[model samples]
Target: MKTAMLEREGFAALVLRLRAEGISDLDLLTAVEQTPRSRFVAPHLAEHAYSSRTIPIECGAFMEGADLAVRLIERLRVKPGHRVLEVGTGSGFMTAVLGRLSERVVSIERYRTLVTDAQARLDSFGLRNVILRHGDGAGGLPGEGTFDRIIVTAAFPAMPRAFTEQLVHNGVLLAPIMIDEDRCIMVRLTRTGSRFEREDLFEVPYLPLTPRVAAFL
Candidate 1:
């Protein structure tokens, strides 16, 4: 399907869903619509391109739709010149949405197969700002200077210190952090001086951040 169809087939409604959740930025909305989710999806699952929910891709991983991702991305306050780092690159859908809105995006996926597939799909679209890496996402992130926005899709028992370190002072890191075994909140952390301000935004259930988390701290 052409990208135009995405606009006609409920993309606006999806953007509205994000907006209703406090995502009101025009650039983010445009990126969500302009990025072709289907291109990142496995061919077998292309039929669900417009669904406003998570869809399974390779391995048991799922891509959270535009509604949830845009809402989360909006709160991170990504601007046209911001550099963003994402810990999970499922289907590369969010990365693409982000790629449209930022100066540069570095996405890391623990699953190598997903990483390669997402890289290929992103290449097809000429979305050059998205850079993919295969690694242990829970181990936090390596410094490539600092980012204005850091996003993590998988839930972690706690926020990774490396993530905070990789942020430019006052930058935002959005991640699902656990309060308990079965309870987690997608938090927005703003780096302020030497500490981070934690703001719990919403409840979310996700596969936990990897065991490699301890390796970093």
Candidate 2:
């Protein structure tokens, strides 16, 4: 009983901090509050789940910090009826949040173990709107049909043409692009007829988006 209270307190504190950081969307806050982040992280990292810090997960992947994740989602402008395509599922924490905010979420992860583990967590939380796939995220999911919104968690040297082509008309795609050897910045590309309008967000430190599926581990 005491532990549950502590968890609730931690969530409330986290939400307050996020609010102070400029996250004013009530729906987004509620979704984050409702999702138990501890379940998506390793047992040893449970104490750090509510903090706005990146928690390491299986396959040597790092989950985005809560503050940054929420910020990115806010910029993505997810709507209740929107279908979102999330590349790089990582720990699936963002996938679960996206599932709550959108009509459906299709997330792709390069590592099979991450996909399997994330699926179990989503299932345990009764999140049926998220579909986890084990495959390469470089090309995005072309065959899954066009999505209303697409978000890539990893950094790429440049926006992949395949990803832009996978967006529906006026669809938005947010991804981090490497500016140089040591710097990366998030870019938002919105499909406008035959072209995509680009907007640069803030700099981020995300791992590079690798191609092809992981053959092992």
Candidate 3:
């Protein structure tokens, strides 16, 4: 399918996909439709682009579980002018999505190769709002603390203190939390006063948030 077709037919289908997934934000859905997920994916996965299914891309990475990603970002309450931090810049897919929805996005990746590819791809797409960082995803970002939102794309074994401390009061953290032996659960965290509270959401598998998150703490 051509890029132009995504504007209309693609938008329609994306609306349905989000609706099926319970994404109620209309404007966010529009951004999702316009961003063109197909371009960021492997050429072979292009055909499955708008199906609400995450397909495997280059470098042994799978875009599986992106629909949950969209929902999580929306739940994060990102406004157009919000500054956000993203842990795990894999494929830069979610980073690009956040870039479109927010004014500034600082995304960190532990793997050098993923950082390089994500930077190149996002730059090619003209998403200048996203700043790519080469570092450990687990450490939380060094300078960009007090963000309006911090998104962790990979699942962490537990919530890192650095991550929770970095959030400003009322800032939301959306990430996958590992619950049991092999269960990866998605959760939304809202910082209140001196403490934070979590609301458990769904279940899915993702690359566990790397150990780098807690290296400094």
Candidate 4:
């Protein structure tokens, strides 16, 4: 893949475009501007990093475009003291964004290479509030305890009980549910006592959540 690096000026322009498109959250826009999307994508794909188009990363995973990332964080409404649990780290772009929006982030990725690389990229920016783990994202990281917000990057067949159990009361869980062969819908699942209230966010195609991480040689 032929990749092009986005220059600092280009990135700033991208941020401006996002703002023009009605992404009104100042914190979210600033986070998107400060974080370099190019660092998360392959060199050949770096040119598309800031564009609102999903790009391939290591481990055959896809990084959600900047637009989607912004939307997700805005809907999450992460507060400075909020603790976030991210089910899929992917390129760590989303995790990095979440780290800035919230007080702390615990991100889990099934791919070891992605876990290592994403952590390295995040560390390069000196972001210490984000924790990366190599494990099945379907099973929420329990040792870290309940979270104020949870975001699952991959599509799930349905809302998993494991994730619900790991969310704190009044917490939000955002994930895509597989609805058809070529269709998936993003749903916001909120935990209130023992009941989960579901709201459809939008529709997008995504890779399915797997039972286990693929063997990486």
C-alpha RMSD for every candidate = 3.6, 1.4, 3.5, 2.8
Global local distance difference test of model 2: 0.88
- Model 2 Cα lDDT, one tens digit per residue, 1-217: 6546656877887778877877789999888877877777776777777777888888998887777888898899999999999999988888998999999999999999999999998998899999988898898997779999999988999888999988989899999999998889999999989888999999987978888999897
Global local distance difference test of model 3: 0.76
Strongest candidate by lDDT: 2
Clashing pairs in 2: none
lDDT of 1 by residue, 86-130 (tens): 998888878888888889999988787888888888888799888
Residues 1-217, model 3: lDDT tens digits: 4655644564576667778877878668766765777667776666566666667765566675446667777788899888899987777777888888999999887767777788887888798889988788686876655788998877778877788878888889988888876788878889999878998978867767655533321
Considering every candidate listed, which one attains the maximal TM-score? 2
1 versus 4: better TM-score goes to: 4
lDDT scores of the candidates, listed in order: 0.78, 0.88, 0.76, 0.82
TM-score: model 1 vs. ground truth = 0.88
TM-score of every candidate: 0.88, 0.95, 0.87, 0.90
Residue-level lDDT of model 4, residues 31-127, one tens digit each, is 8777878888887777777787888877777888777778788888788999999888888988998888889999888889888999999999899
**Model 4 — which ten-residue stretch has the worst lDDT?**
1-10
